[model samples]
Target: MTVNGRRVPVLSAEGVTVRIGGRVLLDAVDLDVHAGEVLALVGPNGAGKSTLLGVIAGDTQPDRGRTVLDGTDLRRWRLGDLARRRALLTQANSVAFPFTVREVVAMGRAPWASLPEGDDDEAIIEESLAATDTTHLHSRTFPTLSGGEKARASLSRALAQRAGVLLLDEPTAAVDLRHQEIVLELARTVADGGGAVVVVLHDLELAAAWSDRLVMISDGRIRAAGPPHQVLTAELVEEVYRQPVLVHRHPVTGDLLVTPDRRGSRPTRTPVAPAAGAALDSAFVKEFS
Candidate 1:
């Protein structure tokens, strides 16, 4: 959207801050989600990536600053209204009741109930299930599905929503290798369809390959935000992740690959205290000599 000839972001977080028990989870972080692109939030554990995502999704209240959707404050929008525009797939896919997979996926259409848009709900649900490879489990109870199945089913729900903005937190965390690639491809498809997709990814290689932009968060603040090639470097990875790594391009795909550098020398001996009887064993060996 453009206002006064200026392009506006579909969703944005400005100076967003969140604190819990005097510990800062997010500190004055700003981010923008634009349509037709996939933006990834990546960092080590407890680096405020999820907290910032929740703030943008309106699931977590910010102690300072604000999050906006189409220039309107997120807090000002009604829950149902927000649900129609933005769908969030959280890390946990737990359902309290024994809802069938189909039933759980259908819940995404609740915001459009009694509206004309509900007419396509069934078709969308089926497409979503098939897209996520969850169609076969539609009749099964969500509680009975395996971890990867549950994750896909939950993703199917978010896809069924048809929201323009998707906030996904580790959508492929529990998925297998094949499904992980599938999930990333789906994210790209969503972005290609003109949706704004913001995903939290732990795998830097996947993020670099999938996302149009990468945001590296550390210590409750954004360390860098830019194109993957610019943001993901060997020095930055080592500094932020605190582990030496080798960042290189894939041989065929040409996309970036990040792997820990395991070239260090191993110690000659174990570093531990000897047992009480170890010296006596040494003396017995000496007697044999």
Candidate 2:
């Protein structure tokens, strides 16, 4: 497939599985990501979302199936070539030693070391910072920045790579609510710019809000894969999460929203008003009189 002069189906996996200590972490899972599209992987904790990202990012090889990038097996690509064409932002990224934001963002350029260091690099770095809304933090130390700020900086580093495929694992974790929107907006911008994005998200609402397609995983298998409105139904949520959830369209945008119902497990009880002329009421009335 092709989209806006970029390759559609930029990354794909077939029968991918991961196992450890004879325990299956992921079972025969499959997914496809296209350029100019955002595909979200959503599931509960221990559902293999992050492990799937690792498989797609070439950090881990599937035990049973194949991962293909742009029609070629991912294993065939050279490390440098893969680095130049794809970027992976893992869940935990920390700067042990203090480094300025600019230096950190510059690390994204490591794959293109042969290229001349000139205005282009600076421009790319600046654009990445601007896209992630971290330009103001250029002079700040990475260790001194807040958790949200660090996430934005890491995102900027990935953007600076200018790769055609982007993979993220829990990109919004540890960020404040406001920064969550900011990070997701940047992801949308990346897709709009003709890149393919695959993200693992814990928040179903965020996934429904931003994803062009969704893949729901459970017990390492693909439970559902399709548009959010179609795949994120109440029945599917209950089946995969073992909990009741309500699916409703946003009143304004009409986007699908998934909300877990905590009251599902508790019996409904109606409160009764105190009976008139009861002993408690009579005592209060006598005192007042």
Candidate 3:
């Protein structure tokens, strides 16, 4: 039922390398994105995480390798064929014209135009807007949105694409605390539904919390890649980032937690027991979820 203990990757980048203006952006990078899994790409700034994602998205061609989607090389697919199979969310989502948020999300349905899939366009658009919490902003012009609003609106468009593989670059970069969890939860739901999601995140703990696997890159190469528990050790974090960090389990959820050492500059206190906040948590979950 599996290929070598895993399902065949829906998208794969093999021996991928990229050079821009004589600088090596990525060097011999290899990545696999499998269905039913969320893969988080994490690293410090300018660590080729985005470059690797672009290669996977077919937006940036590799200098020395090939990218495959569903067992075929990406270059072989037509533009609309490729768009219908995967969706990409970049750092900036700008529309030159004053298109309404509804119109912007509608653009995602273009790939399926003239096909049977086009019949479900309206229902899908509504679902995507609700998923990103952008349903209320549908009538607003894209150019007038705030940073967080624009980010969520852009996410709605990508979701509307209904692609099997989702590539997100810093999807949570402009969101607030609550929306950050929402964005990652959306990514998790996509993977759970048998799609593949590759998200680039700067928040190490969030990446560890949401992803089935973490791929850490630095200086144009992968430094570590594995399940969060196996790859997010304090030694590796400090080594790759050259910054003092403390790694431990969350007090309540037991998820991995990563934080800066701070050189003992702050006072420490005992954490409250989980039972103390159970009632309030239940109320919130019951109301929201």
Instruction: Note the Cα lDDT for every prediction shown.
Output: 0.94, 0.88, 0.94
Residue by residue across 1-289, what tens digits does model 3's lDDT show? 1588876889999999999999999999989889999999999899999999999999999999999999999999999999999999999888899999999999999999999999999999999999989999999999999999999999999999999999999999999999999999999999999999999999998999999999999999999999998888899898889988999998899988999989876789777679867977898999999
lDDT of 1 by residue, 1-289 (tens): 6679987899999999899999999989999889999999999999999899999999999999999998899989998899999999999999999999999999988898998999999999999999999999999999999999999999999988899999999998999999999998999999999999999999999999999999999999999999999999999999999999999997898989999998774557555457746887888999998
Q: Where is model 1 poorest over a 10-residue stretch in terms of lDDT?
A: 264-273
TM-score of 2: 0.87
Clashing pairs in 1: none
Q: What is the TM-score of each candidate against the true structure?
A: 0.91, 0.87, 0.90
Tens-digit per-residue lDDT, 31-60, candidate 2: 888889899999889999999999989999
RMSD of each: 5.8, 5.5, 9.3
lDDT of 1 at 13: 93
Better of 2 and 3 by TM-score: 3
